[model samples]
Target chain A: MPALRKGRCLSPILLALMLVAGLIALPPGGRLTANEPQARLHNVDIREFAFMPAELTIRLGDAIVWTNRDFAPHTATSAEGDWDTSEIAYGQSSRQTPTQLGVFDYICVFHPTMKARLIVTR
Target chain B: MTPIKTTLLAGFAVFALTLPAFAQAGLDDLEVAHAAYTADVIDIEYAKLALSKTKNPEIKKFAELMIRDHTAVNEGAAALLKKLGVQAKDNDFSKALLKGFEAKKKELSALDGAAFDRAYAANELAYHQTVNKIVGETWIPTVKNGELKAFLSQALVTFKAHENHAGHMVTAAK
Candidate 1:
């Protein structure tokens, strides 16, 4: 009975080990597993009439959230008219996910001097 | 500071020193709020006049931004005052700002076409420079209320941005 109990205890341990090993052994660039890095959310800040990073890079599926730390309202509007996070007021935030993979230049419509760029990669 | 900023500061200091209204020791919290709110209203008025008179796209865009931003700032000031359960008291500084606005209105009303746009751009630049100087150098230091001080600090950043934008517009309009 002691040996039987030992076997039962080792079963889950071995299974967990196998699962981890399987995840590790999965082919690169094949398919995303439970342990693979997934889409991420990045943050940008607007303060003193400028974007904190002024430029960013992310994966295709990643998202960016812009928070206004200035008293004035602002927007992240794409130069090509592709996307716009419009009228983000003080203490407010807006989010965007780029569907296309490339470089995009954007500016605050209210204050055109405020400029930034985003790089999206697959 | 940049040369332009230094010039703006020196010019604003002279303008402020000339105004007997702001030379007082300091303004109370309500008085500060009143002056800030009045400034917002005056900018909105100027923007409206710009919209009515100018056909230039750049000037029109700048005017629209002034109206939207100043209106928003005034609304925020009004909400904060309501929350504190007090009304902003009209002081000499506020009165002086209104008087100055009336004088500028008459001056701007006399111009037309590109001349009007150029004058409007220059006025916006000077107005922002003066307001930013006062808000940064005066009210932020003297206001006793923590919330009001914080509000002014944030508003100063926006006004400073406006000063820079106006500088660019002044060049473009010319």
Candidate 2:
């Protein structure tokens, strides 16, 4: 009974702290709306001469950040030559928000063997 | 012996003497940096030569890539050395690399058009293979500095990718 009481007593306090932490972690100008999904940031790491996630799927409004974790420079360039995150150097990053919904193939212009796919959905 | 042949043999003898230094386990951080930078410069020079001689778009593009990537890697190496407040030390391995480069460059310079492209691509394949092996199996393991070791590890990945690309170029140039 005592342990049960302690659990009941801490639940609301812990919930309040988590809520506050979530609010603080929100992006600038982000609002918690009940009817709409929030845009998110996804990371794609370049390491060991390859992309961490060779394929990715994200929502239309979400952004993808390609971080070059390798010493050599890399780029996230669309195979169709439409979008390019030109030269993300070592320990650097670049972000791209997809403007259309479809599957897009990309490669590092420097190392064409580095290929990946991005699927943007509604 | 003919003068050019004699000179070539003497150059090879000198380069062979330096080969042990390259294979020895005593390479310091600065020596490794010097060798890595020298390799970059050699590749860049080869690429520049290729660019000047080749009209094939694929070969031209590969040459441009070599110039861009090698220059970028060299710049990164320079920045890291400056940040560490150290300079790359000149060593026998770097000297040997330059000596070999001089002869190879002269050989490549004598060719034009397809022959030049094929030779350039073949050299790139061989060069990247050698550099990648040294950086991965030799320098990265023996480097005493943490930052330098990490830098060499990252550079090895890039160079391995270059090796693969160069292999493709060799096939395409033929």
Candidate 3:
């Protein structure tokens, strides 16, 4: 009878332990941990009238943040009028996350000579 | 009206009408060069003050750019003047602009921190706007020399960009 009671006690404890393990295995936000890739952030600095990395390559869904370190205002204006960062003042930043796969050429509307290329790939 | 008084009034009216014309006679190549040089110098002077007085990184960067770009412009103007065998001549407009800049510098020096940044940025915006207008509307049309006109035209493009940058600075300071 004592052994039977001990088994009865062990059953709930085992169930609780199994429940906790299941909870731990589940991903945060209850989302599926399957084939979804994570997005990433990349930084591009503007200084001395030019982008630090004048050309950048990134995968789709990745974001690029452009920070203006120069005293003058700058704009990341797309050549095809697809995207623009308006006027990024000194020490200010703007972000662009390209969804399409293509090469986007941009220039500072204020400083036409300032140019950069962003390539997005699958 | 009495005859002498009428004559005097007519003379004054003639002077008034011609006064605008005289002022609108616009700057000669030498005066234009001088004005351009003086303007750059004034910008550099104010920028140096901004650099020393402000702690904001944005304003400091702007001040540095002002110093760099204006210095380059001044050097270019000087070289152009030398190449053309023309001596820069001072004019009433340039003198007044210098005086205004001096007063602005004094006012800006009295402030600190964000106040200084705001005032400096606003002043830069106003200054560039005025310069852009003068270069585009007055100087470009009235400049008699071919090279000088082209120079003013080119400088107008730069001034327009500066004006836009200054406008951004003004908003950022606010």
Candidate 4:
């Protein structure tokens, strides 16, 4: 059926629609809509000496964590001093409360070559 | 050893010693990547929400790309975590995002058609511009890897494209 095909092919389309609908339906100060898992995330791989995820999205109240897999140290610093990791050491971590909702831009302070986005939904 | 060879040998030894600190700094993001990635997933959700409901066709397409590409990119990030031997737990930031999005959902929904498009476009412009500055100003110079340097060099491409798109929409709206 074309409906099924559309569903399959345009799954991303439907997802886009739902994403917007979800935002439009978001409550003030960001209240979780569904009782879905709290840590719904997209991991960013730092390999080939690059920030793999490049950009990512998370709900308000969610967190964005970074890891250093390569042979060099990297940092996840937010632009405009919004939020940042103070040089997450190799095999170490940093965490933050993205309570404020907005598209936050960040980069690894050490590498300057590693960049990522933390999109906090609200 | 030849004079040039001696110089090269010394450089290699010093380079090896200095490289560890560079790697150590990069690894720090790993500590935050998992949690950060989840929060960012929420951002994509918002961008898509704005796109689908917008009256503007271009905004719609761009939103679609944001959703699809970002999803793939995020997934890749997950695999990267596995490769690097990292495990992530759901943290407070993710909880806050869910709560915030649920709160803002209705207002964003109310802005329909052109109004929705304008808001969405403006938001995109802001987001991409910030991304560009961070990548150019921060990420590009963060690492010691030559390959990464070149790869990061291209990050501005998408941000610039979004800027142009959003700029057009904003200009059209005025």
Top DockQ hit: 1
Retained true contacts (fraction), each candidate = 0.58, 0.54, 0.00, 0.00
- Would you give me the overall lDDT of model 4? 0.54
If you assessed candidate 2 against the hidden native complex, which CAPRI class would it receive?
A: acceptable
Runs with alpha carbons beyond 4 Å of true place in candidate 1: A1-33, B1-17, B20-25
Interface RMSD of each: 1.4, 1.8, 7.7, 11.2
Clashing pairs in model 1?
none
Q: Which structure among the candidates has the greatest lDDT?
A: 1
lDDT per residue, candidate 2, A1-122, as tens digits? Answer: 00111122236676577557663233354432322456789999999878879999998888899999876678999999999999998789999998899999999987888899999998
Measured against the true chain A, the candidates' chain A TM-scores are: 0.75, 0.76, 0.72, 0.61
The local distance difference test score of each candidate is 0.81, 0.80, 0.73, 0.54
For model 1 the local lDDT of residue B164 reads 89
Kindly list the per-residue Cα lDDT of model 4 for residues A9-119, writing each as its tens digit: 336676478657763223343533442334444556665446777777777655555666543345778877766767654455565666677887777654444566777
> DockQ for model 2?
0.40
Q: Considering DockQ, where higher is better, how would the candidates rank from best to worst?
A: 1, 2, 3, 4
Candidate 3: list runs displaced more than 4 Å: A1-113, A118-122, B1-25
Deviation of model 3 at B160, angstroms = 0.8
- Model 3, B7-78: lDDT tens digits are 433543443343234335666768777777787898899899998899998888778878866765566677
Q: What is the lDDT of residue A29 in candidate 1?
A: 45
lDDT of candidate 4 over B1-174, digit per residue (tens)? 445334433543353343333333443343335434554475588677976686666676666656653554455556555765666545443454355445445545767777666655655554455445544655566644453444345334434544665667667754
Residue A80 displacement in candidate 3 (angstroms): 20
Residue pairs with backbone atoms closer than 3 Å in model 2 (clashes): none
